[model samples]
Target: MTLHPIESGNFKLDGGAMFGVVPKSLWTRTNPADANNMIDMAARCLLIEDGDRLILIDTGMGDKQSEKFFGYYYMWGDHSLDASLAKAGFHRDDITDVFLTHLHFDHCGGCIINNPNGNGYLPAFKNAKFWTNENHWNWAVNPNAREKASFLKENILPMQDSGQLNFIKKTTKDSFQTSSELDFGIFFADGHTEKQMIPRIDYKGKTLVFAADLLPTAGHIPLPYVMGYDTRPLLTLDEKAQFLNEAADHNHYIFLEHDAHNEIITVQHTDKGVRLKDTYTFNQLFK
Candidate 1:
């Protein structure tokens, strides 16, 4: 099995929003903000090439929103979902499975796109089965007031409408095991969003975790650095503490979805608590 880092693109978001209650003086060092207090973020997704299946985890924000809508977040960068796939000698049609960590626009927007001739939304990966948990699917579709904005209908409804959506059955087991070469086990965390599935993949004997929004960047390594967008902030603290302990214990590498500067981070149990030990690009591990 071969794993490829597919960079969808880069966009800017309010540092305060990204870092939550964390102070500017603190998070700014790791993610320097612009005059608008917005920090650049990467919509980095992962692609796994196994024998017959090419699985893509999280599709970056697609270029379908209106100008006014896009004005809120400034997007910059040459990377694109299609372009990155082409670079990997593949196309959208080549994908067989799209495993979505969650339904947030930045994470799954690229899964659906405007159809040709402007009919309506269509599946971005025409040949892939979109995978999302039943709980997350229900939570996103029937979103609460706090999360309504992040769960954009344009980025979600099309999947179910296209008849390509499938739910990963919730198993009673502690860890979800996959027979595929990805060697990923889905771990559900409710703090960030309801039933947010973090893919823990064992690649080349090293456990690599797709941190999603649970741990967006290295700046979020501190136990208290929780996102403002999380539904249950206190639960996030508990979840992070537990997850970090496990990651550190197992020497797992965290794949950050939004950190424009650092793609992957390893944690260490420090005197102050859990802290980032090393930061590197995703490919660094494979190398």
Candidate 2:
């Protein structure tokens, strides 16, 4: 099995929003903010090539939203899904599966695109079966007030409407849900959303985790550095603590999706809990 770290795109999010109640003085050390208080973030997705199945985890924010809509989040960077895929020697059509960690716009927006002739939206990876759990699907379709903004309909409904949407049955095995469909185990964390699935893939003797919002960046290594967007901050505290401990103990490598600067990282149990031990580019370790 070969893994490709896909750089879908990059954007800026408010450092305060990204760091939650954590004061700027602390988070700034790792994730320095710009003049506007926006911190750099990357819509970094992962692509796994195993046999004939090319599985993509999380589609970054697509290029469909209106200028005004995208103005909210300061979009920057030259990287794109197509360009990244080409660099990795593949295309969207080659993807046989798309496992979404969650339904947030930045995470799943690239799932759909404006059809030819500039009309209605359609699935970007028409050949791939979109994956999301039943609980997350229901929660996203019927979103709460706090999460409605993040769960854009255009980025989501098209998957189900296209008849390509599929659910990953959560076969609870130990702490994670084992899915025979993909080569990874998913650990569901409700703190970030209804059921954000964090993929744990064993590749080349190292356990690589797709640290979605559960651990967005190295700056979020601290237990209290939860995102303001998280529906349940307190729940995040518990879930993150457990995950970090396990990652540190098992020497698992974390594939950060939103950290623009740090791509992959590993944490160690420090006096202050699990702290970022080292960081690596995808090629540095994966190669």
In terms of lDDT, the best-performing candidate is 2
For residue 170, model 1's alpha carbon misses the true position, in angstroms, by: 1.1
Which residue pairs come into collision in candidate 2? none
List model 2 lDDT by residue over 1-287, tens digit each.
Answer: 99999999999999999999999999999999999999999999999999989999998999999999889889898999999999999999999999999999999999999988877889999899999989899999999999999999999999989999999887774558778777678999989898899999999989999999999989998999999999999999999999999999999999999999999999999888889899999889968
Each model's total of backbone clashes: 0, 0
Question: Local distance difference test, per candidate?
Answer: 0.87, 0.93
The whole-model C-alpha lDDT of candidate 1 against the native structure comes to 0.87
Residue 265 error for model 2, in Å?
Answer: 0.7
Q: Model 1, 135-200: lDDT tens per residue?
A: 899999999999999999989999999899998887665534452433468878889999888898
- State how far residue 28 of model 2 sits from its true place (Å): 0.8
